[model samples]
Target chain A: MFPPRSQRILLAVLAASALLSAVSGRLNPYFLDVALGAGISVVLASSLNLINGFTGQFSLGHAGFMAVGAYASAMLTTTLAPRLGLSANLLQWVFFPLSLVAGGLLAALAGVAVGAPSLRLKGDYLAIVTLGFGEIIKVVLQNVDAVGASRGLTGIPSHTNFFWVFGSAAVTVYVVWALLNSTYGRGFLAVADDEVAAEAMGLNTTGYKITAFVVGAFFAGVAGGLYAHLKGYLNPGGFSFDKSIEIVVMVILGGMGRHSGVVVAALLLTVLTESLRQTGAFRMIVYSVLLIVLMLTRPQGLFVWPLWSKKEGRP
Target chain B: MNRSVSGPRSRRSFLTLAACSAVLAGCREKDGDTGAQAIRLGLFGALSGSEAGLGQYTDMGATLALEEVNAAGGVLGRRLEMVREDNRTMAGESATAVKKLLSRDQVVAVIGDGNSGRCLEAGPLCQAAGVPMVSPAATNPKVTEIGDCIFRVCFTDPFQGAVMARFARETLHLSKVGLLVDASAPYSLGLASVFRERFAAEGGTVVSEQRFSGGDKDFRAQLTALKSAGIEAVFAPSYYHSGGLILRQARDLGFDGPMLGSDGWEAPELLEVAGRTAEGSYFPVHFSPENTDPLVAGFLDRFRRRFGKPPTGVSALAFDTLQLIADALRRAGSAEPPAIRAALASTREFQGITGRISMDSGRNARKPAVIIGVRDGAFRFLRVVDPGDPGRASS
Candidate 1:
């Protein structure tokens, strides 16, 4: 958790982010477009960062949890909102949060289900399992009629705006960052530092690993809920393997264990992606060239070069 | 609930922030029109990516119509301007592109979306923004069902299937048929089901039915089964890529009946893959370049002169879509979004490059579908299937 003084500033930053977002969203949809996209990316990266960075679990199923959360929450809102007999405003302001939380909880259970088997496996093996899980989820979703099958589910209320998106982003960051300051977070760090040492120290490494995995999945689910409502449409293709890899890139390029690094990286990638579409035919060409140049210039990450690096032996 | 109350100070600020944002939203609820002189129309589609091979035709067609409309003294006494954006053939990108077009470009009408999924993503926003969007080639039934503001230049999916079944049963005199459906594709599956139902109702027997996923290139087994059944024709409701492979495979297996398909075979690569075997194949297209109609000929001439090649069916549909928008604008007599939508809805007997197009209340175009056959490495005109052709027998 942030110190008391730092917490106040963090709270202020959150407040200002919301205020700026609202103003931009209202003034013109273009700014809202950037903010909304960046905000979702922030949530997704921050959640995945909890697992892949702090816990050192190489989970590639971030987008799968996101899809599950998105489809579930979207299904609830689209089907129940009208039948709940609540006004549209009330449905969004009140019931939507309930659906988002429910979606997150379900995603957490899925994370547990996938984690229980593969957490004991080593790095690349875990990555393959998680990657496989992602593809399986996408394949399963494609065949499910309840979610509109391959055609995708439409008529999802556009309940997501800057406030909801940035609000969820703030909440995701706060919860994950706060966990890093908790004893459970220390267990996660111990496991990442050395699983053998963590086990010898009676830290229950597997339990700690599961906690991080569940927390990561929960936030990813929340991100999915925001995404579905924002896009007002959800296709299995939207949450493909490429999407899962995208979040992993943010976590890696942001730095392994730095919150601000992940935040900056997510915003950069999302805004860069949407803005670069203006390049027309060359957007894809520019995207790969930019990534290659960045990789060559700073292999550690875009922002992980100095600010958050550990300086040892300073005393 | 108590925990959510974080602290008195933070809670107060949160409330203040929400109130402020609400006020701001109210302030900008109704944006003031800048009242630009030019009537801005928007076009969005896959200008790049896998589908771009086909979608590029759509881009040219819309751009050509924009040029033609502006050259003929514009719409509503204003030079019609097109603000085109590339959707990149992705789902979320289409929604983003439409949002930008509606807000940033402030386009009153959008003509776009050669693909159905992309159109579905963009349709909701156009409906919400009170802007009209006409999809040039999206054939899914759910697209127009999104809202009244969303319309399409092409016929709906089921109608396309029925058109093919009629062309096969009545025109080609095929009594039995086999279906090689791609179960993974929504477009393929939808057309397959409709064709099956319509063909069965026509007293035509489906002696053989085989299934294949979209990416499956090998269909020797399915082709072998079709050979055994001795069906008169095979209806392959697949895109050009798979359609070409299926036809080539079928020919290799020595099943030489008339291979029927839908507009999914509009791509030039279909002929390239199947080669000489692609000739004598049939499919229903919205517009055929071989049409001797004056309007169709003029479009083909202009298209060939501009792009150095004749326009494909998608291109022709896109050109007609833009012209339809221009026609609606002329009839509405204003650049107002609502009036343009009304004009688009009440569109009747719109004689364009495609054909005479009328809109049902569902925003679907009621028009004749042209059945095209391949011969000598080019699409040749077969016959026009009228919209209300009777003798639709029950199964």
Candidate 2:
């Protein structure tokens, strides 16, 4: 067997190869687009996992962060694109990176504001507060006249591509992965294990929890920003509670806090949902049934086997 | 416990490796192009969920049009293949669907995004990819306003709103109107704005304006307020999902005022949901089912035979959009996006089931609007309002 470091290098090389193949232009751009969407979902699901999985705080307002990111990035790009007066190709190269970071920062700010108030509560109360916050964001976005209000913000120059989406996803995965391995990550796990013990250990449980929440929000915001550029339109309805739930589902089905699990879930759910289009009204019924059954049988998720499991006899 | 921690980390690394391999496989599959014979045209709309009926109708409409075109020896002697995707009434999914159609399926064109918001989301992706897309029923002007590549067959909210507003004033003699709009819906909010502007400009008073979200079933509070406003007419610009519920609740609450709405309320399910309450409710539709024009008659027969129901305005619009696209492709003699867009723009006097369509500078169809009312459990045609007048009263 390869050493751990060699395995990591091999994985990175494989990922790069896969991404290059996606960008090779000979393949249909549509699949590349789907891959891009999967990438964005990775960012959203993994970020959400930080709060809902590791920190043991449930949030259904990830879409709100997405909205903040989308609008902020769109406005920035719109302003900078004209002033910079770069060619479309060059402009895309410069603006996409900047917009993504801007989106993440804005989302992190929103996360702090929402997390500070709601993290004080527990379980269902946090859920309700977060849900309400999501709705409030939608309403606020709808009423903002400068961003086109209910009519929606259109004419956004499309700068998002396969490279940008996948690159962001890689960054999101790396950051979250690094965070999960650090001391702060242990604080998060401690809180998830038992809040009282974590607090007793002088972990500043509130601060660590809020940090996880903010980090998750930041990535969701980045995803949203990428989404806006990809679609070239932004509307309040695009970032509702349903959207938040979708990200949550990805994390849950992928085995929360498990990086590979989330990635698998995002791709599977997207394709499964799309493929079931022919089922008409029964599609959601089937989806609900599948989810329920999965929950009942394997609550630990399809990917319960961790990456480094030492169970010698297991598959 | 320490083992558990290490276990997850190592497992995560392994899983990442596996994910990377899977993605690599996906990329390889993308590179190996199968030289597909036919020109793939994508059909995307709400195919499931709450708006499945709309999606079904749109698919039927597009399919029929494709059938007719194929019967006429196909476009440019190459058979047109439709790659369909269901948006499921969600904007995010709609964007994803469009991307799949454009990038994966390699469709030259796309059609059928019934919801305004979905169309709005899909429009940019099409523009970016230089894919020509013509939505059959998405009437929000913002869809086309995204870029030159995005176009629609139906008239916009402004035109439909003006038509309904004029119908309320001239036909129903409703001078004082109450507005009950879905605040959460872009279509409703947009239609309401135009309706208010046109209604007030045409010597009509909007006595009160009330709001409800898209999924709100109980509209009694808003209806009660509108009722107390002493309005002769109520303009509820919303989809059939909430529109039917509102109309039923309003009738049950004994507020029997004439309800006026734009094209959003032109679904047959409105009658099913609102039942007897749907009677006397007027809406501006792009096409009336009562039209005896030979082309419309043929369309109705085919549609009824296929779907086992009479075609609604949405289906007709979808049908017209497909035909329009086929017509443009024929005229352009190529499926290239830019050529198709130019052909679409220059299209004039093109015989469509709705009317003789001529593309304006904005690429919107210049067609007459029809006012239809529900009577005897069916849509009864009132009259066709001519273009260029905005349905306003002449001095």
Candidate 3:
């Protein structure tokens, strides 16, 4: 069971988010857009946290899985939803979530296909493989005429709103938190700490690693679906290796396996990036400097070690 | 197991979440006051990417136009202010730039995004916000198709491609050609496909076709392949950076045949990169500096006096685009976006430095493309290819 106070906090956060979503139409469109972006970042960073943080797998191709999900779901919404002959509300409310689930399933399958063999390699080798895989997906998407190739897939339905984005973020956070806390999830920690010892102790290390990849990739796919719908456009360049690096930075900056820390980092990074846009041409320079300062000052992740030192029994 | 739920750490995490929300809310202050005296316009482009050279050209052109307008008594008796954002030629950045321009800067009009893909990315956002966007040189046919509020000052790829194809087949009298297409750029892809189709229709044979990604410096492999095919000309539809490299590489590979290009090759950096090897290569542009028209001579004189160099085709397009917007504001007699949109929609026979520009039904500029050939490290006027004029070129 989860902690009672944490549950209260989660409930309170969810209620407030829902209330805000209800009145989102009245809010400034710019802030609403930023909030939706932050929500997607939360989903991506949290799911990435499950693999790279707790499971100790370095995946530089999370964006590849996201691309698979984005393209798969986008194909359905743009190509299939119209043929269903459903009404507007029916298509959005009923068919949209189905498309997202289908997209996530495809991404999970891709994860298994990629992770089954590649997960055997650890650390830097695994990172290189994932990075290559991300590029492969981008190049393949670029040549696929059905998805518009390098010209990019446009006219995607704009069904992603505050409710869908935040609701998915909440679900992603809960799944990642609950799955890691349960007894069955201890195998993941063992694998992360020392794969050889866990294997000697009769733990299915490969299974845990594959499971982490599958689940992580699944949520990443869902996040991609949300992203495709939010922007109403999808391009291979949107899910390039640079995109995967962005998610990794979020997970690392949030302190690996700490769920709350990752969440906070995602929110702050998205907000900081948007706010820095007002600085004109030096926006990116200012953002990089702030990130460097944060990393140097708090190398253990922005908000993790200080608060959880006592709970995790660290010095 | 630790049983405490309300530990100080958990409370702190909760406070962090609250603080995050507070920051988001605090940044939600009302939009900038529009009651100011200046009529603001938004300009955005790839200011720091592989296409940064083109960005510089556009920025310089817009600045010159801004200064000229202000010097000639401001628009509607109010100073015209331009707010610029750099998209960095990256995906999704254009949408964010457009959002900031529309919501925060509250500009009456937006003019920018010379590349088609970036223009498409920002088109829908401007349409939804009821703001008009004028692109200087995004040549894709699909750009203005996004919505009513989206417009461009350049000819579409379909027209540009056909013009190039006809020029290569008829003017050059070349029966065989090689194709070098930029696979990554929508602008290049669109132009390449149309050229392929149109060239075949013109009874010209494409002996070989090769592809290279945008920003690729090593074009020897592709260029060597095209040279071996023994084609008379190579049509490399790419931006200046890659186009210039292709031209130099083709010459180095001993392909003396002319390398035909689209408007994407109009930047001065092409001459800088290709040097003397760029001679005999030809490309279609919005306007040629070699025009004998007094209006063009006057514009070039002022541009040279200001920038100490000849303005590229994009800079000219940018200058005309901003002038078009200012003209709309003057005609509308108001700084409101809808009124400006209407004035822009009614643009007719507007005399520009490029040529006479009229907004067609599709919101595209109905104008001719000027073919400029590089001779002795200078761009010289070749011929004017009117729309649907076939091969009749009046030199």
Candidate with the greatest lDDT versus the true structure: 3
- The CAPRI quality class of candidate 1 comes to acceptable
TM-score of chain A of 3: 0.94
How do the candidates rank by TM-score, highest first? 3, 1, 2
Docking class of 2: acceptable
Q: List the residue pairs that clash in candidate 1.
A: none
Off by over 4 Å in 1: A1-25, A200-202, A275-315, B1-35, B173-259, B264-281, B288-301, B308-311, B374-381, B389-395
- Global Cα RMSD, each model: 6.1, 5.9, 5.1
For residues B110-167, what per-residue lDDT tens digits would candidate 2 score against the true structure?
A: 8958787778778777878888888887776666767778777878877777777777
- For all candidates in order, state the fraction of native interface contacts they contain: 0.30, 0.44, 0.18
Per-residue lDDT over A121-224 for candidate 2, one digit per residue giving the tens place of the 0 to 100 score: 88899989999989999999888878877657776777887677766776777677667776667788888889998889888888987898899999988999
Candidate 3 lDDT tens digits, B82-169: 9888876667777777887888888889996888878878888899989999999887777888888988888876667777888898
- Tens-place lDDT per residue, model 1, A57-159, is 8998999999989988999999977887998788878899889998899899999999998899979999999999999999999888788887789989888
Q: What is the TM-score of chain B alone in each candidate?
A: 0.79, 0.77, 0.72
Q: Best candidate per TM-score, number?
A: 3
- Per-model i-RMS in Å? 9.1, 3.5, 3.9
Query: Which residue pairs collide, candidate 3?
Result: none
> In candidate 3, what are the lDDT values of residues A1-315, reduced to their tens digit?
766754665676677667777788886666767778888999999999989998989999999999999999999999988887999888777888888889899999999999999999999999999899889999999888889887788888888877778778877877877777678787888898889999999999999999999999999999999888888887788888778988998998987877777888888888887777668678879989999998887777776553455555322
Instruction: For each of the candidates, give the backbone clash count.
Output: 0, 11, 0
